[model samples]
Every structure is written in structure tokens, then in C-alpha cells.
Target: MRLSELANPSRFNALAERLLPWLVVATVLAFALGLYQALFVAPDDYQQGATVKIMFIHVPSAWLGMLGWALMAVAALGTLVWRHPLADVAMKTAAPIGAAFTLICLVTGSLWGRPTWGTYWVWDARLTSVLILFLMYLGVIALWRTVEDPSRAARAAAILTLVGAVNLPIIKFSVDWWNTLHQPASVLRLGGSTIYPTILTPLLITAIAFTLLFVTLHLMAMRNEILRRRVRTLRLMRAAAANP
Candidate 1:
């Protein structure tokens, strides 16, 4: 089905229902295989040894962390420009998930850095930018709650999202822009990835799993948002009927 068709809440719910089960199955299988390759099958890094295993989770979480915000920014444009029916819902539901991934990225990065850098934290540009991105996600969620009216809240949140998008490129280019302890892009670069196929394979698989997981959660959240709106409307109608 076309995405435009799914703009209708009923159609969206129907499509989500059909897709959710398959998504769940595929996500589970991908994760299982990805984990197997990351842990047991893939050879340990000659330098980092077992500590390199964390890369499987860390890289994917970090990728999702950035991707979630970009998705929200797109949704924000839809709300501010075309006023797409599902745009606000997409933006709102994405906040918590993005925050979660950002949190994971920070925590895993710290863990990886502890052994490699011999420290738990640093004020490096890349790390700091990612931290700011996490804060931005939380800020958006708070902004949504602070306003009571749906339209007003959506507009406020959309504005904030667009403004926060400036941080994305900063996060991406921070390493190059500053002399940070964090390493430069290895997987995504102008000269192509520097990672060996052995490590790259599991990372790619896990990244796919993470993306599927995000899609599944986003669809479920949107369905719930639709139901909540229906309930609110019903309650208002019942109250009006009783008073009239």
C-alpha cells in the first residue's frame, strides 16, 4: 500500500497490523544472526580484543540516534509546510525512541572508551555533540507536554525540531572540525569504509535489525496515538450529550 493511503488513521492502523507481525519476526531473526556474528563468529579485533564486540551495538545505536532525529525533522517540515495528517504523530512518537537510542549510544560509547581511552568520559566534540542531541530529544518531548492544545503543541515542537536540526551536521562533522579524541568516520567516508568485511558484516546486519525495530515501534506508537485521540473525542461527545 502507498504511504499516502496510510495517512488516513484507519488505513494506517490496518497497514500497521499487517506489517507489525512480519517486522517483529524479521527483527528477531536479524538480531539473533547479528549477535551470533558479532560475538562468536567474528574474530576479535587484534588491538581491542573482546572490547571490540561493543561496536556492534554502539555503532547501530548511534546510527539510529542520528537517524531518528533526521526522521523527526522531516516530519516537522511536513507539519509546518504541507500539514501532513500523520506528521505530528510521527514526530511525537519518535522522541522517546530517539532519546533511548541516544542514551544507549552515550552509555556504550563510554564503556568502549573506558578500555580504549582509559577514561569513562571526555568533552570531545563528537561526544559533546551527541550529548546535545540527546538533550534535544528530551527537550522536544518536554515542549510537547508543556502545551495543552494539540495544534499549538505540534507547532511548537515542530519549530524546535527544525531548529535542533542544525546540530546534526555538527555532530557528523565534529571530529573533522575539532581535534577530538573520538575517531573519524570509518564506516561512512568519502573514500568508502575502512572496516574489514568480517566486522562490517555484523555491523550492517545489526544496523538493519535496529532500523526494523525502530519502524515497528514507531508504527505501534502511532496506532496508539490514534486510539487515544478517538477516546478523547468520544469522551467529549458523551459529556456534551449529557449536558445538552
Candidate 2:
């Protein structure tokens, strides 16, 4: 398919239909393998013991929480700068999904922390930044819902999404910049990963599974949005005809 075809709603819908099944299969298989490895194969952390298993879910949730917003930033640029037709759709669909993952990260992090940090919550820079990110996502989603016109809502949400993106970098570096309780990057760094190979392998696999799940859900959501807009357009046309 041509690059421009990606911008066409009907074309995207067709492509998504074909891709969704494969993506679903891949997501399920990856999750199966990842869970097996994380649960049964990978040994517990020497310190955290059984609680270490939470890392499999928490780490992926954290990564995707950031990734979802980063994706919206790119889609926002497409909306404001390039005026791509599917840009707003992509941005809109990703919000709830991202929010969900961020929520998972927070909940799982808190669960992991109670045992590890001796507390369920904290006001550290990293944690606060993530909370802000989650709120920004809700703000963008609310902006879209309040605006009656799709084009206007797209533009408004696009701007908010871009502005909120600054938080992403802050979240990544907060631990290093301050004396935060959160740990810095371990799996990815200037040097090699600090995590044990057995643990790292499952983490990577689970991350892939979550990412695949995101792509599958995002594509499905976009397809639904396209159809919804079509219905709205048709209804507007019908009302205009009746009034005339």
C-alpha cells in the first residue's frame, strides 16, 4: 500500500480488518509465552522473592504508559502540521488505552511498593509526573468529547497533547535528576542491562505482548471511529435534506 493510503479512512479500515486477526493471534501467543516464563521459569529476585513477579506486568505497563503518549505526540503533529486525516483518530483512540496502562502501572507499582517501599504512595517527582501524565490524558479526552465538531476537537486536543508531551522526558529522568525513590532505567541504558538474563528475557517478551495488544486495540478503535464519523456525516446530511 502507498504511504498516502494510510491517510485514507476507508483504506485504513480495510487494512485494519486484515491485520487485526493476525495481531490478535500474535498478542495471545506472546502473552502465553511471556506469562509462562515470568511466572514459572524466571526465578524470583534474590531480594524481593515472589513479589518480583509483579515486575513482569508493572514494567510493561510503565513503558506503554509513556509510549502511548509519545504516539499521541506524533499523531498530534500529524494533525496540526501535516493535517493527516487519520491523525486525530489515532490520537483519540490512544488516550483511553494509554490511561488504562498508566493506571495499571500506578496500581501495580503501588502493589509492588507496599512490599518493597514500605508505602503505597509517595510524592516523589517520578510518581507525580506520571500522575500528571494520566491527568493530561483525561483532559485531552474530555476536550474531544465537549467539542461538537470533529475538526475543531481534533485541533484543540492536538495542541493539548503536544503541550503535555513535555512531561514524558521529565518522567524518564526524574529519578536521576532528583533524590526520588523510583529507580532509574535498568533494562535500557548506556551500558548493558542490570537485570538478570532470565528475568530480562521474560520482561522483554511481556513487553512485546503488551505492545502487540496495544496495536491491535488501537487499530480496532480507529476503525470504529471511522465508521462513527461516517454515521455522523450521514445523519447531518439527512437532517439538512429534511430541513430544505
Candidate 3:
């Protein structure tokens, strides 16, 4: 089916109905396994000790924060270019989730930093860029809420999202391009991941769990938006009939 076809509310509703149950089950299972491995199975870091355990949640949340914003940017593009009905909904729904993940990442990173890095906050390149990214998400969401008309709101939000896309690259490359306290990439580094399998496995599983959780919540939010629009339309139609 075409992308537009998939944007249909009924189609989306049916798909959500079928998929939500399985998604929930899988998310629970993955989260359980990931937590077990992260907390129990994996060995402590030789240097950071128990503080490295935060990586299992913090890294996945940080990754998802960026990934969610990227997805919002793509949805914004689709809404502006193709006028896909669901794209605006997707973008709007994604903002809060992305913001939440970013907040979690920052908080957990601070907690992890206090024990390891001696300070909770830094003006490092990577840290600064991620903060900018979090602000961008807030800006888009605020713009959408401030606009009165639906189309106008969507267009405004899309423009803002596009403009904010610059920060994504900066966040990704900041560690490499600048002298930062944040360690350079290990899992995403050249050659291969430097992390051992035990630690890597739990991290990967937690990442997958975070991804699935995003999908599930995004779909739910989109469904709610669709129903909200439907209610508005119905109310307008009823008012028109009464006036006519």
C-alpha cells in the first residue's frame, strides 16, 4: 500500500489493534531480559565499577532521544511535502516522547557522572549539542500548541522541526570533532565495538526495548489524535446542520 493509504485512520486503528498486544508482550519480555542482564549477568566495569551499570538505561535513552527527533523530522518532511494525513500526527505525538527520553538521558548521565567524572554538569561539546536538541523538541511542541488552526500549526511545526535538524548532526559528531570529557564512540567506533559481549548484549537488548516502546507509545498517541480530529469534525457537522 502507498504511504498515504497507510495514513488512513481506520487502517491505522486496525493495525494498532492487532499489533499493540504483541508489542506490549514483546516489550515486557525484552525489558525483563535486558534488566536482568544489565543488573545481574554483566560484570562491573574495571574502572567505573557499579556506575557503569547506568549505561544500560542511559545509553539506550540517549540513542532513542536522537532517533525520535530524527523520526519527527522525517514525519515533518512528509507532512510538508506530501501532505500525508498521519505525518503531522506522528510528529506531534513524537515530541513529548523524545523530550522525555532526552530528559531521562540527561538526568541519568548526571547521576552517572557524579561518581565517575566528579561533576554533574559540563559544557562539553556533546552535552551542549544534546541540550540544544532537547530545546528544539520543546520549541516544536510549543509552536504546534500556540497555533490555532490545524494546518497552520502543522506547517509551522514542520518548519521548526526542519530548521532544528542541524542539531542532530552536531550531537552525533560533537564527541569526535571536539575535545570533550565524554568518551568517544565505542559501540559505533571504527573496526568494531570495543565492548565485551556480556555488556554489549544487554545494551543492545535495552536499545531494542526502548525502540519498541517508542513505537507503541507513538502509535497510541497518533490514534488519540485521529479520534480527536474525528470528534471535532463530527461536532462541526452537527453545528452546520443545526444552523442550516
lDDT of 1 by residue, 60-155 (tens): 999999999999999999899989889999999999999999999999999999999999899989999999999999999999889977788999
lDDT of 1 at 147: 91
**Model 2 regions more than 4 Å off:** none
Runs of candidate 3 with Cα error greater than 4 angstroms are none
lDDT of 3 at 243: 100
lDDT of each: 0.93, 0.94, 0.90
lDDT of the structure predicted as candidate 3: 0.90
How many pairs of residues in model 3 come into backbone collision?
A: 0
Clashing pairs in 2: none
Candidate 1 ranges beyond 4 A from true positions = none
**Each prediction's TM-score versus the true structure:** 0.97, 0.99, 0.96
lDDT for 216 (candidate 3): 87
RMSD (CA, Å), each prediction: 1.0, 0.7, 1.2
Clashes of each: 0, 0, 0
